[model samples]
Target: MTQWQTRRDDGRAGECAGGRGAASLSGGPSAATDAVLPRLILDHARDGIALLDIRGRVLWMNPALERMLGWPLDLMRGRNPAEFINLPENRPGPAELAKFRYLPGSSLFQQFRVTRHMRRDGTRFWNQQSHALIDTGRQDAQKMVVVTCRDITDQVRVQTALERMKDDLEHAAYHDDLTGLGNRKKLSQYLGSAPVRASIGTGRVGVLQLDLDKFKQINDTLGHAAGDAVLRHIARALGATAQQGDLVCRTGGDEFLLICCDVGSKAALMSRAKAILRASRAPLAWKDQTITPGISIGASLCRGTPPTPETCGGEALIAQADQALYAAKEEGRGRAFFYTPELGARYRAERQLARDLATAIEQGQFIVHLQPILHLRSGRVTGCEALLRWQHPTRGLLAPPEFLGAAAQAQLLPQIDYLAMNASLDALVSLRDQGFDDLCLSLNVSSAILADADYPALLNWAMQSRGLPPGCISIEILETSFMNRGAPDGCDAIARLRRLGARVALDDFGTGHAGLAHLSTVELDAIKLDRSMVGRLETDGRTRVIARAIIRLCRMLGMEVVAEGVETQAQIDILGRARCPLVQGYGVARPMPLAELPQWLLENKAFSLPVTLPPRDEPSPAAPPAGRARRRGDNSI
Candidate 1:
């Protein structure tokens, strides 16, 4: 029979080269036939193969074994196989496999798990040592074992993948997908089913709801991509700001709910809040855009009750946090506020105040405060704008912030509008009969009135009945009213009023982002710069520079300029330098009723001012020739 010895091509590992064994076997088999079988098996083997003697000497090997182990088969003769062949620790090596009990007369297959095995150059492969014992009755009638190996590296990789999927599935079940924080379901499970603590404990649960301010504006104006970027940035910041016991989650879009378990001290919670605020203010570097995101946070502490601190309702905590968030926004953005009993009281008070407003309006608790509008060119009291003030009996006199929202809710806007409109029109008609020529009255009109089909007819009837000049009455409109230009019959109402001889002036201009854009679209006779812009104009000389630029722009567009909310003489001085055509605010006169109109006229003796025209004043171009301008400026009774 023939035996084989195997070694690597590099002369270090085993290569099985088939060789004839001269020994004769006792099994009734021919010696030549047995030798042919060993040679045939070694040459046809797929893996590198080898044969070893009892003394661990490599006698024969195949060509595949030499290439597989990087060793030459010839060089491996008479060497200890254990010294050169590597074995894995967890499995049997060649020496261990040789100890397998076997009958020398019979052929048997034995597999030795490779504890560790190495290449000729010392690299490793997972190997399985497969062998069989056979008896050859030659050379003292000895028995031999033949061995082969196959690599299993790719199988190990597949096994690792299956393990990872199992781990990921387990994680996804209890954590939020967006932020990897504990989800609401997990929170409910923990608070509901978790074990208890001692009767006396420091277990407080602080839940905070954080909302991103101006996030919707980014979504609407810059596309949802920007909005998503902002959300992800917020998630990262809040996650890092949280404590070991705190969990932060994205409750929904642009809203993060943080849960701090066992937070007992107010000082500790405040410290945590300061950390969150600092992190939220960090700049978000996304897609080359650095966005400084602002967060409004509302925090509420759950009351503790006995063993395990009886858990508070999650919905109640969320609601309290939401109210706190709203208050934070009202106070200004980028802040964390705790929900307190005082805040709860304020909430109840404001809610009740909002409800009582409609009744107040219907009861005629709303009065008109007439602020005098002065002619800039001649410095004469040309008109007055009827500003609405609400006199709530219990709440005292409330301004626009008080009743404006309620008027909209009760659908009493038209009623409120008519009240102010008629009162000013009646007073003007009375003043005209008292020989005040060319006197004008300006009343604020909502887009609601323009939407009314009878608005043009309504104003015409009132003007004709009073024998008043149609051109002497003007309506003030906000610049933002045209934002919804897509409305049906867009601006048709404003156009009809123009056709009815009522002039229109744009009010609160320069306060909106699209203020300049609205100017060319609407046919405005004058632009009233808003208080913020006027107040801004004082601090920022650049603001007046912009104001001058706007004045230049209005002049190019053939529109007049009116400066609103001019309280101080300095504001008037600035307006004078800008050559504003009109000014209205306390710097001129306070709003009074019809009975006081003649008294104001007598005190100013406005009629004589244009005759002694100040060096800086220019008589209005609207003033007729010389005599009319003189009489209108004549302030004496």
Candidate 2:
């Protein structure tokens, strides 16, 4: 055996003496050994290689280490690795690792950790290191640790970019774009997660639903930008007023939802509701205008009661809160309501009705019924008001009040309005073909249609396509639509209809916020007295007085005054005495289908010679009939 000493390429002797290591080099147990080959391999290795004493002081470094760290081997040698290596904050440094107890003579290999190393220029690079202890096999030899490092900066950058992308996606998924609040996705996620339910397992949690009353008015009148500003302010107010651990979300247009965990009692929840109300009610300065949006809130609670099918999860709670919210709106806005079993039952019933309504529209179950409007003086059916009736597959005829709210809420009112308009137009053409050519059909238009600028053009096109004159169709809108200050476009729609030779009437007058002042500004062919005024005329002297005033004002404005809901002879007599020009109700004739109108006219002897109207002071394109009629009973149906 020939013992050989290990030496560097620089002719410096190394600590290790090779016996079989020298023999293994030549593939035989002989003295032919090449110690320079091992040093050359380490010096030229692609990976940065460093040899360190047990105390972690660098003994030698490869050329690759010098290039990777921007430090030459001469500058790196004899320096502690900790001086140049940077670990993340709170991680142990090389000195700490060296002090860590290890089994004596243990030779762990391929130990890996990613660390940041500072270059001589103070720039940092990420390095993935594999460290191991190499035994020198000499009696006075100190153990040398070999650390092999590869630059992993590009890999780390890719992983960091991926992480940032994931975070951005999470933020977009959870936040509402307009309000910057948590969105429906966040709400659903939080409710399904364990953290929210962990605090109150089958116990008390509260959900409060908030809606901005008449929020559409802001959007319609001031522009959507103002509405968006209002919504953002409302969201901020809700967030600020909410206590810790409360989840607030903007669930829909003009709607918000809050989930409160560990709610102690109804009173505690009420306090939160009040805070939100106050915050929202605080005047918001927008576009140089003070906008105080009214907020309606409804709350539902899941108490310690065991979870049932009805109270299973957050969705059920949300449904209950929605019911309460409807009640709050009904009870007048700017208040809060708590969920009750009765409200829940009613909500379910209404939901079912809404579902049925969608089907009814699709299946053409909705039929148009025309109630004859009689000229008060001549006792003649001049025109008919088109009333909506749902001819259910099982429930028989249903009135508008039964399903209109549901339709409005489900955003199906526009469809219903379209159907009704078509039915009315068809009926009008049918009536004209049946020797009722001169008759005018009064059809109710919804706010949704009036909001659309294109609706006027569509209506004109429909009438033109039918070869029917626009004068044959009269558009009627609720007084609330007229009273809407935000939607001047609705009035514009009315003007557009008038320009197309269609008569416009304000329906259900005296029920909404419009007053005599509104009559001065709102242009119309007629103003129909609301049923409330008509129904109470004989009983309530105040109603009689109001009706008389309304009729007088309308007449002076050259607008026809139609009295609605005149069910009794006395109501009719009183309206006649009040000089109301037109009246429509069960008293005149119940709302009959389009097919029954001619028969009803024949049976009730409702047709006199066609009455001619006097010229109005306002010079309307389609004025109401006030002219004297010639004696021609030959025009009978």
Candidate 3:
């Protein structure tokens, strides 16, 4: 394309510098062919070729030239090319090309375009016409000018088609298939595009990540087919309410996202969000079933040079929104809340607790509390379960529920195991020194640590190095953790732990879909029924039935069952009579402080075990029953 463009001294468009005369340009060679040789020279060129005489007349033009210009030779000849074909005679450029003036006395060529060139029939096509002057290799030869015209209409049409397709493909790449809205991938890409304050003066762009509350439960109860329908309907509702040019995406299951742009104010943005919520709350009908979906929305401003989605990044906007959403659920459902500076400060405090918890074991901030698990039949203190607690000095006895929450949020399950291991070891040493032999102390274990390949070595080193009997130290892994049915090496971790002489307690049984299967391979020494199961047992027969089944299942496996959260004496009498051997509960004692537990042991030293069994020998009426009617006169069984 780097042609030798000849420019006039005055900066006008000119033809190529190395222009050849007709004889040299083509040599079909006949003396008779010589006079019309320039015509022949122009005839076969691919680009439209036209020759215009100095009088502004089209003296001759080629077949390709006529086709390009949409003109015939009969109509074109003897008329000025300009009269037939129109152009912007006064284009802004160098004086000579603008005026169509030739350079003085030289073999000059010019390439100038006609803005609107017309055909012989008055139809127009765009042309990029080039003009050149030639010498006949004779002294008095008239300067013959050659004009070449090329049509660019089809090229323009194809280019237009390609541009449209490019836009469409780009849209397809980033949009959700069903919603015709931005997908997560496109949202991420758009987040990457540097957000700048438009001089057009729209307010800042903010993102709201709204996940439907209890969505999974709904999906499970109703069916994912209905779940998918609800999701689509909600998406449609929210999409209809979204601002023009605003983006909406279904990030994942039942989580729809909004990228709000050009709002007038925060209040206006809030209104938009409220609209979405209202739209979602409207009942959706699918396959003759009507259901209402509730949305929990977290909105945050993208406040930087290139604002990324706070919703998508770690501890970023999503966490803020999520915490706020959860807080809304805590206060009540069917509500919306904004994350404020106070919430952030509270989150910072919680996160600090989570982070400090990393070194909790290393710094000896965590300690174990041993609450005695009494045998229902034996009427003796059989064992104690090691409940992990953070004895945060300044904070003062932070319960497992407090820091454990943040630990789960931070996804620090391994940290819990690490701390719990040391805490368990220390408790074993303490229990041994206290002459509490033949007593089993259980420590809670997370599924994450159990899934670790090196968990056995870690547990062994902690237990064996401390001269702790693996039999005396039971590790309580949650029942739900072992329920990954098709997991690679499923339950293999627990099997390894059992081989290491550590008894695994299936903590929180009856909490998941897989109940029996969890106990099958878990090799549990015990099962602790969750408090939810226990709390409703007196009222809900179904709960009592499940507890009875769980107790029977544990007994069948030769495993002891510990019913947790035993608050009422009735609960105790229920389990005691059912002969569910061992139980730990608030009715017996709340998780006492490690310091207070030893004292609790001493205070309850003359422990008339609150257990039931048929006497080995018949008790004479004369001899007082061990638990006196006054031990009953205190009237708290």
1-637: candidate 2 lDDT, tens digit per residue: 3334554445555433334223233333232236555764566578999998766678899878888888787776877766656544534666676574323354446357887777778788888988887778853248777889999999999999999999989988999988888999999888877877674465568889999999987887788999998999899998897767789999999999999887867898888899889889889888679888889999988753675536747888898888899999989999999988878788888889899999998899888999888776666677788888999888899999888988988889989988988888898888877777657788888887787778888898989988887766778888786555344666677789889878888888888577675677767777778888899998899888888788777666677778888888788778767767787888778888888888777676544423344434433222234322311111111
For every candidate, C-alpha RMSD to the true structure in Å: 13.6, 7.0, 11.1
Tell me the lDDT of model 1 at 173.
Answer: 74
Return the number of clashes found in candidate 1. 53
Question: Could you tell me the lDDT of residue 442 within candidate 3?
Answer: 78
For residues 26-123, what per-residue lDDT tens digits would candidate 3 score against the true structure?
21133223334444455556787666655445667877777766678898786656555665553233443335534535343534764556666666
lDDT of each: 0.68, 0.77, 0.66
lDDT per residue (tens digit) for residues 1-637 in model 1: 3443433334443323333323333232332344455666566667767786644457777877776677787677665455566554434466765674435443336445543567778787666666766558665326666667666656656776888888888678777775576666666655454431211234466777889988887787678888887787778878887766566777667888877775776667667777878888888776767778888888877654542333345556667777788788878778888887688777766667666766765687777766677766566777677777778888787777677655664566787788777767777777778887656777788767656789789888988988876777777877666454332354676788888877777788887645787676767667788988888766898899988788768766767677888887777777777766677777777777567868787687553322222353433334333225333222111
Q: Give candidate 3's whole-model lDDT.
A: 0.66
Q: Order of candidates by lDDT, top first? A: 2, 1, 3
Q: Please name the candidate that would achieve the greatest TM-score relative to the true structure.
A: 2
Total backbone collisions, model 3: 7
lDDT for 223 (candidate 1): 81
- C-alpha displacement of 452 in model 2, angstroms? 5.2
**Per-prediction TM-score:** 0.50, 0.77, 0.60
Clashing residue pairs in candidate 3, if any?
13-110, 14-109, 14-110, 15-109, 15-110, 310-317, 630-633
